[model samples]
Target: MSELKILIVDDDPVTRSMLKHTLNAHGYLTAEASDGADALAKMAAETFPIVISDWNMPNMNGLELCEQIRKHDSEGYIYTILLTSNNAMEDRVKGLRAGADDFIGKPFNKDELLERMAAGERVLNLETREALIFALAKLAESRDTDTGLHLERVQRYARFLTQELVGDPAFADEIDEEFIQLVYQTSPLHDIGKVGIPDSVLLHPGKLSKDQFKLMQSHTVIGADCLKGAIAKSPKAKFLHMAHDIARFHHEKFDGSGYPDGLVGEKIPLAARIVAIADVYDALRSRRIYKPAFSHERSCEIICGDAGSHFDPRLVAAFERVHEQFATIAERFSEPSELPGSAEPKELEMVH
Candidate 1:
């Protein structure tokens, strides 16, 4: 088992020391906080999956701490338990409403405390699902050798673009902290369907013929079907739903000129639209078998120039605002040989 760190928050030094000693004896690493405010400050500096907090504290109570933890924007879920003297049903309901995962009496038993922590561990372990998702995506990406760090670059690009739109009045209602995180997590799966493409077509050294190109375009549908099955199995998984949207519709164009299903304008999922620009930008900036990497300036010109036709104009405008950041992300992740070089703009075929 991995080292599990638990944060203990209580005003009483005796209680804190006792809990820490007990947890440490059971092979759990521990951190101490004097109160809820102190706990929040420590949490900002480090990740704590399980927090054992006393309900009464001077700076901030355990209830307020639970509420703040829910809003803290950490990457993983924090399983919080309230140590409270009040055993009333009303108090427990209040704790639940405040986001407390579990509760223990003020004089918590060693066995009961350990058992509660075990249950919290089970909940935190579910985060491994994210690791599984990324591994699966990487497996699919491994098939195409030319796209070095393509998934990483696209994930960053999609996240940066989504963050920029948070302030826009048009997307203010749609874009939020959760939506941005989901886009970052699921963007890498956009080309997962390409795994199904035949090696002959996917590994083609030169431009594909019309018939070959038609077959290549089917990757979008293929990837969507795979994710659709996953969604059916885990219908509540929001990340899979967004991944499904990106896989199915990232190739769809703004003006209904794209393949598989030519979804026009807003008909295309917003997540897919954001990913479309990210995918194309990486394609334009990365070296390919048939084309040298285009300079950042040239890539920007092509993407901005296609705003209304090939890409969403609003996203294009957002890209223009943060295009330099996009360049920085590409450079940060690119190998020395993959660095963009000056090349004349060419009428490139639709990037796979």
Candidate 2:
């Protein structure tokens, strides 16, 4: 295993020195902080995935530190371990509620410490899994030459809409921080099934025939089935479950008019409903072989016009509120080649 840089926070110099020496001896890099406050300062300046802090301190205790860490806008997860002699069940509960991942007795055992670190490493390894998921999504996207940054833009739009819906009473029970993150991470896989589409149909330079369009629509099922297989192997992967839902249902219309399964209204998975709006909006704004890119205002009008027919009305309302932000994100990630007047139109490919 590669060495992990850990921050040791405690007011006791001896304990800090001992812990740092033990960690460094075991191929782990160590940094010392006098208290939780000091640790927070260091964290603000540097990235540390693991934090070992004592329960008792002058400025801030370990529990406080854990709470602060959880509240901080860090880009990645931080595994926090609290060191305390207090063995009371209530104290342990308090630490857990404060966001502590693990606890160690005041007189810590070296083997136990290392084992806990290993467990934390395993948790951090989820990051690697998420990266692999995106790579797989990218592989599917590679089949289409015209979808430059489509995945990136769609994920952002989905995340933005989901974030806005967090305040809505109708979705209050559904959307949360984890939901928002999952939408952002899994939205890119919405079209992964397109890989199964034959080039003759997927890359056709003209409008698809009735049979070809039917085959083209099968990409949703193909992608969903691929994720279903992965889910069968790892049933507990929440991201896969969401990705499966998005892949299968993102193309479903809100008014019972969509394909594969005519799931209408709230019956469609909420994640899929949210992604449908995002995907369509980006598709409208993006340049396609058959259609030129639409302006932000024009895109908004089309989306708003189809609020109840193509998208969930609640989500459409949320989109209306954040339409400006969506345009900003689109502009930020827009490919220069996709911009208007940058390139002449190519042979048309049928887009769903």
Q: Top TM-score: which candidate number?
A: 1
lDDT of 1 by residue, 136-161 (tens): 88999898888898987898788778
Model 2: per-residue Cα lDDT over 175-256, one tens digit each: 6556776887799999999999998988876677899999989999999999999999999989999999999999899999
TM per candidate comes to 0.67, 0.67
- Please state the error at residue 225 of candidate 1 in Å: 0.5
lDDT (0 to 1) per candidate: 0.85, 0.84
Candidate 1 residue-wise lDDT at 119: 84
Backbone-clash count (model 2) = 1
Off by over 4 Å in 1: 1-127, 350-352
Candidate no. 1 TM-score: 0.67
